[model samples]
Target: MEAWLLLLACLLIPFVVLLIAQRGAGKTKNGSRIPPGPLALPVLGSLLWLRHSSADLEPLLTRLFARHGPVVSLRAGSRLSIYVADRRVAHAALVERGAALADRPPATRALLGESDNTISRANYGPAWRLLRRNLVSETLHPSRVRLFAPARSWVRGVLADKLLRESEQAPPRGVMVVEAFRYAMFCLLVLMCFGERLDEAAVRAIGAAQRDWLMYVARKTSVFLFWPAVTKHLFRGRLKTGFALRRRQKELFLPLIEARRARKDRISRGAGAAAALKADTTFEHSYVDTLLDIKLPDEGGRALTDDEMANLCSEFLTAGTDTTTTALQWIMAELVKNPRIQENLYNEIKATTSGPEEVTEEEVNKMPYLKAVVLEGLRKHPPGHFVLAHKAAEDIEISGYLFPKGATVNFMIADMGRDEREWQKPTEFVPERFLPGGDGEGVDVTGSREIRMMPFGVGRRICAGLGIAMLHLEYFVAVLVKEFEWKEVPGDEVDLAEKTEFTIVMAKPLRARLVPRSRN
Candidate 1:
């Protein structure tokens, strides 16, 4: 009996040793290593390791990268969350193996109502291709973007009047520029969407309704991330609020969308010439009209329902406004803090423009320094720190590491732009880096083959609105700089501390004295 027991123990000991070794290395049953990360606690997984909500993850992600190197994994319950902070690796995997990293996380898509619609959240398939192509080709194509030139020019005058009214008060207090930025962007997008320049009250109502929905999305809707089957009981109230917010958006947007549809219908019924004369709004083309016309080949050849149309319009408005506001705030703040850079930019604008008579949209292209400043602002403070999470379509290998299928992938946009290895004085704000003979002179924002800095993400999922976004930023910043000196308030210093909302915004809203240089 003793001899048999001893032989059994010796055999079992080696197998136990192998199991222990693999577990120590964090290897899966298939002997694949998920990237190095903090050990997960049972049930909670790595939730305890996180210091804040997922939206505001810059600080938490920064620490994780430092501890575990560029590629790290965090287990969110049963889901594996993988983060890639290194830009070189990001380009190699996301750009080269775009298909593998193209699909979105299942949970995120379902939660965002993008499961089968919306270009940003649609899965990788025929529907996605159709929606993306429509968005890029029909809605925001280069030619269509030029059609909004009148709207953009109008917004500049509105913004200037706002800054003047806010600053011309007693003693020139800090004029909170956040609202102005948001309003201007909302006006521009609303006009592009409905082909109408609405009054201030109507625009504000639309902005407010959209903001309510965005607030629920960014703040109150955490339970959606969990498996709904399990959290349904707990999250019922929040989900109801989410629905109510959706109804509010439909209430506001349905009217605008319906008006567009009515006009389109009249034209389709052979009243085309007469309808054009009677129409209250005239857009060379409206995005809503484009949405109304889409026939989804994947969804049994159905046109978008009124609800879906509302959601898309909401998405169009929210996507354009919040981000532009954030970028404008940052650019204006930097200009306020660094007057010397502003002066140089102003001088460049003056040199480029023919005496600065409101600086027409066509002339904006000639101002390189203004473009450089906008690009630098985007690089330093990208609207989104991480691209919307990408999911691996299959078990993929990159640089000797395994990224398993069904895993969520994210890249650190802020970290990539600020990588000390790639940028000189990475923390400082300098627009010249993107100018001629400068550090980032020819750096490509698009990661076609290589990614230097992606303020708008790269890969097939790169922002469809990239061209319009750049034009909007460049045009607005140039108009503002030409109109105002944008000086820091008396005894109040400029603060660039970041706070995450829908986008990364200044913790203290940008407030400065707007000294008019030229009247629009």
Candidate 2:
């Protein structure tokens, strides 16, 4: 009887909350209607539909858009989520009137693990600006990015050597490249974050910790979204697991962070101390180093706490590694499937470079075809189908639909890129479309003006690591193609079918036969 009462209370609480919250939810003060969606049941909202559907939200959303229109709203208990599938509407909301929609939803704080503290999840205001500015200026700026060239080169070598060894081991069946791709990215990002050339065992440990935390948040934390206060007690086991994962992240990261902090302190002491630290260090600057120097004026000029630093470092590692690895896998898979395109890209790389030395950043910039291949890959298989959800700062209307101040609004990133209105053949993998005389020529990915495709997103909330992410993708893809001729394995064909995870990854992890090309 007591258990039944508890379950009844759990169900009733959210219903009552939704009843109170829905008072004026569908209309703005001016009486404009919100985007139309399915008629949500009282208390339950559209969650019944969600419960019945598979993990992937796209198929369900696609059907809803077919019935409702480009903009669709779905209520999950007390929270109202608005999804936009039209490009013009997305452009208007995210670009033309971006400030009105720049804020992150409050629930993101819990869902994304300390969203208020990190640059990606922080609410738009002074805190967000400060964090974003520090990251851009200290780490991602062009001049600063040049400092990490050696790190990228080293990671490239690590990736190439691993792939060559794996190909040698499994010559007939081809090598499963996803794990190699993920590990190589982690190595590069871990170096950039902590400013060390860690042994493979150390790198793997940190990567495992980060991945565990991310996967937990992505899969398990959503249950607590409606009312975390109540669910915390009800789902104590999950809560405990989440805390354990976070603790593991701190254990792995804090040591590296402390080492950098110690180095920073020693360098400040005198020339002798600085020389000693520099002699042992692998790189000059790191994401953690910049983070350590930050003093938040809004927070009494206090330096960030150990927790905040760990969270930021975790973000730095995950953000740089996961999306890049996913995109690289998709891009390489496409090359394997289409041998002609692969040969064309290889020819371009060959023509541009003097010989088969690793393709430098400069030579990569010169190859239009390589740039187009990367662009097409992003457009076709965006790492995340939706950009991190944005909140409507105020009641904002776009294309005649009202988005109330607190509602969560997310743009359909994959839909926008695949919109037949924008591209000639949206589904096909054609890099040439981004070249001159093609529809995508001179397309602005930043979406400052128009948004044909937004893999990195647009407006104030655009990805901070856009420049570096592009460089990594281009450089690695160039090197891989230059070193190997990626071909489809017999009976183990490249499958484009995707399964949603933290990002959309190929359902069948890309297994490709690699033929080592002789250097000229």
Candidate 3:
């Protein structure tokens, strides 16, 4: 069945919207570290109180800090959850005790697949360490990322073309191109993963199917996280549907995997036909190459299972696409609402691109204003409200607080972004704050210096795609501004309110009117 076919089965997919646990859902444990929170329920835990919005989680986390304290613990039935809002606490756990706290929470096992210790979902283990090392050295290395330039450019062209088509006969209010952003991101990631470019229609079909599968998995899997047996029996239909969705993913991906393997074989034979393969700009480079090339330690000196490769491939595309696209939407909305800042940024781009060749990688690295704009946006609206949950690998103490070994620890990415002590006028959208000589300026976002804001996370499990994400953001933002002048449609003010899924995104899709600037 088509992935979209399952869209009508939300009734069966009750797990999608309901399993999310609220930040302050339950009562606090009487002893041990952290502060206080709401009361918990049996089995369902504090998740019963969570609303539909993940974007709302961050603001709620901020509010909870005010009401309770910086560090608060909540009881979700038998599970004890702690929310660390203070920078010091965050630094203590994520940085100071980095290795000891690098394990992913055990709750992630269901979707993380069997054993759950791989990149992203994997816990701290020999396998995870090997996976992370292999990924950094092989697939996501700076050199490998450089090979993706053509992919980025292709998607950007598609994005610009789509915007142009939408604006051709504008009826006044800026066209709402929110879905365009998602599609572009999906296309880029798809090409990156499959290493082969598809026609626009194929790209759209793949993107739509992927989105459907993701939405379903994200929503339904929450149930399995907290209450295993009861949810399994109660939501049997959802479970079946989930299985069907996974099968659908296999249908879409398995073929691509097979084709890539065939292509690799052809090239290995020194076939002249393989030489006819189109330019780097045309044919997509499969991420599978990296996976196929790297030998995992798990196969007992043999190759990894198809399932493991699938998980890694899916994760590479899904993680980067959703979060980056969501961040793109938020950043564009910020530009639309703040035109002066947009113009200033445009001027910076104009200066860099005043000559002939398109903005080079080196040139992009030099744009302080553009860098600040992205940093500010990331700080204001982090992709994930909190980094993926980190577990205490060993009992550790920091700043008089003790986090027991194996405790699931979460840091507030949004709270740190808006921390009043770290950022001056934290609520305002002041890109200048990140500029030289400004408050919070000169702060390193690389997480090497304490944890103030971590959108991609910190320490051992920090996003492997961090470099690629930054390149895409800066490149697209620069090209986007150069291509058209963005404005806020009068009736529709850009709403900064956030919504949640895997990533914290704008509740309402961004709708903006694009007027092309004189290219001359």
* Candidate 3, position 256, lDDT: 78
Judging by TM-score against the true structure, name the best candidate.
Answer: 2
Ranking by lDDT: 2, 1, 3
Candidate 3: tens digits of C-alpha lDDT, residues 301-332:
66666767776777777877788888888888
Which digits, one per residue and each the tens of the lDDT, describe model 1 over residues 417-436?
98889889988889989888
Model 1 spans with C-alpha error above 4 angstroms: 1-32, 41-43, 47-56, 107-115, 277-280
Stretches > 4 Å off in candidate 3 = 1-35, 39-60, 107-117, 272-285, 355-358
Error of 2 at 506 (Å): 0.6
**TM-score of every prediction relative to native:** 0.92, 0.93, 0.87
lDDT against true structure, model 3 = 0.74
Q: How close to the true structure is residue 74 of candidate 3, measured as C-alpha lDDT? A: 55
lDDT of 3 at 82: 72
Model 1 residue 365 lDDT score: 88
lDDT of 2 by residue, 1-520 (tens): 9999999999889877766566446666566788877766574666556564436578989988999889999877667789999988999999898999999877523733553678987888888899999999999999999988888889889999999999999989999999999999999899889899899999999889888877887787676665566676788888778878888999999998999888788788764544645454467788899999888888899989889999898888888999999999999999998889999999999999988588899999999999999999999999999998999989887778889889999999999999998789899999999999988999999999888899998898999999999999999999999999998889888889998888888999999998999732
